[model samples]
Each structure stands twice: as structure tokens, then as C-alpha cells.
Target: MDKSITVACVQAAPVFMDLEGTIDKTIDLIKEAASRGAELIAFPENWLPGYPWFLWLESPAALTPLVYQNSLVLGSEQAKRIASVAKENNIWLLLGLSERDHGTLYMVQWLISNTGETVGVRRKLKPSHVELTLFGESDGSSLKTFTTELGVIGALCCWEHIQPLTRYVMYAQHEQIHIGSWPSFSLYCDITAALSPEVNIALSGSYAVEGQCFVIAPCAIVSEQIIEQLCTDKIKRNLLKAGGGYARIFGPDGSELTTPLAENEEGLLLATLDPASITFAKAIADPVGHYSRPDVTSLLFNPAANRPLSIKAASFIELIYTKQIVLPGSEEVQAN
Candidate 1:
């Protein structure tokens, strides 16, 4: 068999706040993708516990505080069950869990190996503006990619896509694959005047090419179920949305090698890859490499500073459990 591996990004929407429903749906999608020959898989941002969209889409005048108050706890028992599903299916999974750590909520990417082992985990460096009211993501720890059997993989949340420095870190790591987990695209958010849809496809595709790595961008595709839930809630149910649409795969050159799916049609896009593609591309113009001349200018990266900081994450967890330090804007405490 070829050393190349097959991967897919399963695009599906959780049943807005129905943790069991979201987890079950995600597991179902995983099994489906595996049946289609995907060995490694990924899902959109917070594929479990359903991403809360109404948190945006409204002004205090247009949105009711009561509606935004209720959101799914990403770290609850229902989500762990999804981990079991990943193990049982024997597919490496990159899952986005809207974390509820202690009383504080965070958006974390949880990576599970094919055997269902918790391989890597990272928190969103920061939530969208005003989202700080609903989440706790510190700028202290934002970027890194880890080695896997297939290749080096990294994760970054939505909007961060627009941040160049953030992309540089992953690219410098020589990541072979990157997962840009995003909530569904908002039709109402900023869009280009020229062929917006095409611009979007190009934008998403460029991340892969720009980083010189294959990108599995499985953005959330909201369902009518989610629309209905929001519609019914009257509070967060302000019923306005976008994205949660397509799941796409881009080649190293930032070309769409596989076709994307339709909105509301939950499914996956699988693509076979050779890690060598990254090596080949970087040969031409490695942003930080042979093509770069320090005589003109230099990009500095402190790998040493990064190595020691990882311990801070561990220490934070320990403090939360022992000191009972209350997280701002949170009602829950991280339990050891």
C-alpha cells in the first residue's frame, strides 16, 4: 500500500445544545467516513454540544441576554462518549469541544488517535470580540502542531485565519496538515464585493497553500434543527446565521482537490495526501528558509520560550482544581 494516508473532514451540525444528539451525530458521521476509507478524520469547531451562534448575530437591542445564556457544556459526559466513538471506529479524530472547564467556558480542540487515545489538546488563543463574555481563552497559549503517525498536524480556530503571525507559527513548525476549525460561515459578516462565494473558497484554499500544508477545513454546517432550536428559544433564538455550510479540502498549492458539499447536507470530503508535498513546496519558497535572506530582514522564533510555557497549561489546571481560583465570567470550576 502507498505510504500516503487518507483523511476527511466530516461536516455536520450539532442539534444546538442537545449534547447527546450532537455526540451521536458526530459518531455517526465518523463511522460513515471510515466506511468510505478515511483513516484520519476531523470535524468542525465544537462538533459536539453545538456551537452557539446567537451569541453573535444580534445587538443587546436585537438579542436577549437570556437566549445567549444557555449554551451546551462542551466537556460534559455526552462529549466523552464521542471520544469512545472515535476509539471504536479506529480513526484519528480532531474534535472541537466548546469547553466548559470548571465554571469557565473555553473553545478547545481535542485530538484523539485511531485507538481513541487522547493525543493532543489546545485551547483557542482568544474568543471573538465580546465573546470574552461567554468564554475564557488566554492569549498566553495559542499555537503549536504535534507529530502523528501520518504527519505533523496543527489546529487554529476561526477569525484567527485572518491573523498572519498566527499562521506563521504553524508554517514554521513544518506542519504537514492543518485543521482550520470554524463555526459556520456567517452570511451577514464582512464579505468581498467581488464574487463573495468564490472569494471565500479562494480564501479558505489559500490557507493551505500559504502554509504549504494540506488543510482540512471542516466548518460547521448548521441544520434546520439548529435553526428551529434557536427560533424556539426566543432568547438566544434570535434566528440569524451563516456558514455551518461546506467542508472542504485543499492541496498544498491551495487548490481545491476535492469538491465541497452543500449547506445543510451533512457529510465529509476525503482526500489522499503525501507528506512530501509540503517538502516539495517549501523547496521553492519556504517563508523562513533558503529563499529568505537575513541580510534584508529576519523573522525571529523563540522555540526555547515555547518549550517552557507548555508547563503553564498544566499548572493552570492544577491551580483551578487546588486553589479554586474562580475564572472571570464563569460559573463553573475546573474539577480535577
Candidate 2:
């Protein structure tokens, strides 16, 4: 891996509920980042079709069809086009989108290698609050990190960072670069302090300090157009606001690396990361390394994939046919 690398965190809004249009804009953004010498680019969570803020504003039943229509499916032409853009730009891409499988939608982060290979796909283990209305949950298989030329890259969507076990699992993988993908923080700013930008941005920096990794926190912006469309009445308008782009890049020691963009502006927050800084930070306190006392306490992790159906092996059928196995209720098994 190179000693130093430049990274970009996208703070732009998607072409709201339009997958193809958002993909086109994403391609252009990737090109712009590559031209500016970025080796890797990270986009905000649910950026492909934008976050379903309507779930909080109104009934999700009305928008369910639109969400399903815009959600991306793995290996589709749309997904390939995004990967191709990454390859063409010669940059590693971390894209957050609403992934569709069968009839369910999931909050997902896709990692694309510089060579255009789909390196990893991780779904958010659990959607937050109203998000559950539109998105499905993921299993332990979704919690993973990928080893790449840049480093061991890992990503989590929105509130996943707040999960102690999830963050520790990523730290155990020795993730050198972490992406904290978030939707706009423009929801109920005055109504609650928990969803404020300060709290979420602090969580991103805390992740860097705790894991001894570089953090690229890409957050989306709730544009005026989005607010107008989602907020139909005066009460709804009061619930949601525009301008929540608080994209930031932090060092391993929890120091802000890039200058923040305005809450309403759309642009990339660029920062050059040095691996040596991670080393220095880890030297002080590596949570999963020298600083940890696993004998006293440890995490119980189950990394197996959770499948809905379990099929009987063909070998089992062969054994029965050859009279090598007997039926439990029968005295003996014989081949006819």
C-alpha cells in the first residue's frame, strides 16, 4: 500500500427517487474526484435514490412502490455501470444505496475495486426508527471489511457506528480506512438534539479515535427541492428542513483533516491520509490489539450467512439410494 493517499467524501444529494439519473450524476462526480487526484471516493448513505424521509413525514404505504422502483439490484446493468465508472476513473469507490433483493429493500454499502471488481457488499444490520418501515435488516454476514490496494476498507451506514459490537468487529479486522455513510441530518433539527449534525459528526470522529483508522464521513444534503416535495403542508415543513451536508474527514487521532463544506452546499470533502498517522495512533491505544484484555471479556461473533432455506445434500440422497443409510422410523433401509 502507498504511504499516503487522497480520498474524497461526496456531500451531494441524489436525483431524488431516480436511480438512472442519480447514477449519471454519480459518474460525473467520480470523474471529477478522479481528475482532482483522489484515489478513493465515498458517497453518502442511500444516495442512489435518496433517503425515504417521507416515512417520517407521511405514510410509507404511498411511496413503497416508488422506493422499490428506484432501489438497485446487484449485478444489474445499473450496478455494472457504476463499477465501470470506478474502473474508468482508476479509483476505489464506496457507494451507499438502497439495495433491492426479491421484494425487500435494504440499506447497503458496495465497495468497488479500482479494477472494477465488486469487492464487498454490506447491508446495514438494522434500520433506524422510521427507516424500518421501508428497509429490511441484514445478518452477521453483512459486517465485513475488504483488503484492497489502498488498505483494509470497511463501511457502515448511518447509526451502525453507534453499535459498539459492530464497530469492534471492524476494528478486529484492522480496518485502515472507514467510511461512515449518512443521510441528511435535516430532519426535525429543532425537535430533537439526538439527530443533530453535531452528534452524528462526533460519532464519526470517535470511530476514528477508537479504531485507529482514517474516517471519511460522507453525508447527504436535503435540498430545497426535496423539502418542497416531501413537506406538503406547513406542519410537515416544520418537521423537515433543507441543508444538512456535514461531510468530514478525520485522522486516526480524532482530528479533523478536511475543511467542512457548508450544510447546504454540494461538493467533495477531500483529504490526504497518511498511514503513518494510523500507526502513531495505534501505538497509543489500539482497542482490539495491545489495549484489549480478551481473557476478561470478549465478543461472541457469528459470521455465518443466514439463509432462509437449508437444502438436503445430494450425498444424503445417494446414501439412502445405495442402502448405506437407514430411515429413522424403519427397521432397515433397502434398495429396490
Query: Which candidate number has the best TM-score?
Result: 2
Which lDDT tens digits does candidate 1 get at residues 134-241? Answer: 777645345778888878888887767777777777777777788888677644434333213455556568888787888888877767766665555554333344
Score candidate 1 by TM-score against the native.
0.78
Which candidate leads the pack in lDDT?
2
Measured with C-alpha atoms, the lDDT of residue 264 in candidate 1 is: 66
TM-scores, in order shown? 0.78, 0.94
Deviation in Å, model 2, residue 195 alpha carbon: 0.2
Candidate 2, run of 10 with poorest lDDT: 312-321
* Model 2: per-residue Cα lDDT over 1-93, one tens digit each: 457999999999889999999999999999999999999999999998899989999887878899899999999999999999899999999
Which 10-residue window in model 1 sums to the lowest lDDT?
Answer: 60-69
Taking all chains together, the TM-score of candidate 2 against the true structure is 0.94
Taken over the whole model, the C-alpha lDDT of each candidate is 0.71, 0.92
